[model samples]
Target: MKRYTDADTYDNKIPSVVTIGTFDGVHIGHKKIIEQLVEAAMQNNLESVILTFFPHPRMVLQKDTNIKLINTIDERIQILEKTGLDNLVIHPFTKAFSRLSAGEYVEKMLVEKLNVRHVIIGYDHRFGRNRNSNIIDLASYGIQNDFTVEEISKQDIDNVAVSSTKIREALLDGDITKANVYLGYNFMLTGKIVRGKELGRTLEYPTANLHIKENYKLIPKKGVYIVKSEIENKTCYGMMNIGNNPTVNGTHQTIETHFFDASFNLYDRKIQIEMLKRIRDEKKFDSVEDLKMAMQQDENFSREYINSIL
Candidate 1:
């Protein structure tokens, strides 16, 4: 898919069928909308365009610094690329852009900049300064601007809303299964391998410590989880822990993964780990031996779970 970062320079020669949203997780409901968009574009012989914003409008406008996102901008783009979109536009969401009136947005961004022939949007979609425009206003604008507006069904919109909420809640609750069901894919954590205290090696379970750079990307609940990753193009299953190691008297939270039967050094290598299921809550053990025993049990259970799925 062609990706354009500058909205002002987005001069598509072909007329486009567009959909605009944050599309945060690109969950199942969002996938449905994207499917409809692609179908509409094919039927009308127009380019399918997705206009999304970076820095999430809420983060910039409302100064919601504590807000966590399911995917980083790059991760969102990677996920959207699989949906067969013709063009993807990542526009900067600045305060000045947010101040544009509804009419100006439709005329300048949609009609002139994107050459939009049609728009597929949710029934409750709102835009303009302080969200002054609704779907009805969009339709009115479309009528005046010579473009068509397709309102996605209310049921679909509600489903999308519910799915997004449930997915976020499930992930925060460590319900990976429920989150994946709504997302239509495993939740992933991308990070680089970093050095730890080498404590896992002492337990005979050497681990790769993950260091994620995106502060906005949501980390799952503190617990142990069954995860999978591709190392050197080979799929490997592992058990990951997200917590402060109470047994070891560690104070800082860490993401440590111990791949079964793998011994290769991964320091400084970037990797993506897909969470498949939650194993158990992290616990403080009485002694090093007790923690080692618990780790063995966790590994055994993880192997069984992975094997059963395969």
Candidate 2:
């Protein structure tokens, strides 16, 4: 699939059937819309285009809103690439871009740059300087520009909204199973492995400390999770802890994964871990031995869960 980083980067050579959104999480509901989008483009003999935004509009327009996204832009791209889209455009969302009027956004970005021949959008989607334009306004603009607008049904839009909300809540509550159900896939955390205090080594369960660069990526509740990752061409299942090593008097939150039955020098390697299930909430144990015992228990629980799936 072709990718354009911004409106300026798009060549406007292909008249396309387009959909636009932040498309966070790329959940099952969002997938349904993309399925329709691809079908529309195929039926109409045009390329299928998805125009998404980064820096999330909220992060730009409302700087104080501490909003964490379900997927980082790179993660979003990784998911969208599998959806049969013909083109993906990730536009940078900035204060200057947000100030475009309804007509200007439609004419400049959609019509001129994307060469959009048809738009498949959610009923609740809003645009323009103040988000003052709705699907109805977009339809009117489509008429003026000689394109068409297909508004996704309220039911579908509501499902998308509810799925997004439920997924976020599930993740925050450490309900990876529930989040994956709504997402139609395991939610992943991708990061580079960095050297951490060798406390895990001393405990006999060495871990690869993960450092995620995107602060806006939503982290699931601090706890233990059963996870899997592809490392050096092998699928490794592991138990991961996302928390501060409180027993060691460590105050910074860290993500560390200890792969079962697998050993590798993973420091400095970038890895993507897909959460399978939530094991348990993080606990503050009485001593290092108690914490070690708890880690053992977590490993047993994770292995059982992994075996059940296998």
Candidate 3:
């Protein structure tokens, strides 16, 4: 897929069948729309284009500091690359851009800049300053701009809405199975391995402490989960803990994964963890020995779960 960061410099001879959204998780609902966009483009002999925004419009326009996303911009791009799109444009969302009128957005960005031939959008999609334009307005604009507007059915829109909300709720609730079902893939957390207090080593379960740089990327509920990762070219199953270690009187929350039957020096390596299932809630143990025993049980349960799935 061809990726463009600067839409102003993007010049394409072939008109594009376009869809626009943040596509945060690229969940099943987003995939359906992307599939339609690709199929329509192929049928019409036009290029398929996805116009997405970065820094999410909410972050810019509303100053939404509490907004958490299922995927980072790079992660979104990586997932969308697998959708067989012809072009992907990551437009920078700024306050000035948000102030554009509906007409200006359609004429300048869609018609002049992208050379869009058709737009696949949800029925409830809105744009322009303060989201003043609805799908009807967009279709009207398309009539004047010489492009086509295809409205996704209300059923599909509801599915997309429900799935997006459920996916986030599931992850936050530590329901990895339901989240994965909604997403059509495992929920992933990627981070760099950093040094911890080396407490896991003392328990004979050395773990890699993960440090995610993206503050907007949502972390799952604080608990133990069954996860998988590829290390040394092999898929390894592990149990991960996301919590402050109450047994050790730790002050900060941490994500630590202990891979079963695998050990390596990953202090500086970046790794991606795909969560499979939630094991149990984190709790304060009476003593270090009790915590060690619980860790062993978690490892055993994780191994059984992984084996059963395989």
Residue 62 Cα positional deviation in candidate 1, in Å, after optimal superposition: 1.9
Model 3 lDDT tens row, 77-110: 8889999899998889998898899889998899
lDDT of 2 by residue, 1-310 (tens): 8888887888777699999988899999999999999999999989899998888887887884578889988889999999999999989999999999999999999999888999999888899989999999999999999899998999999999999999999999999999999999999999999999979999999999999999999999999999999988999999999999888898899999999999899989988999999888888899999999999988988888889989
lDDT of 3 at 295: 92
Ranking by lDDT: 1, 2, 3
For residue 145, what is the lDDT in candidate 1?
Answer: 84
By TM-score, how accurate is candidate 2? 0.97
Kindly give the number of clashing pairs for every candidate. Answer: 0, 0, 0
TM-score of model number 3: 0.97
Q: After best superposition, candidate 1 residue 113: deviation in angstroms?
A: 1.3
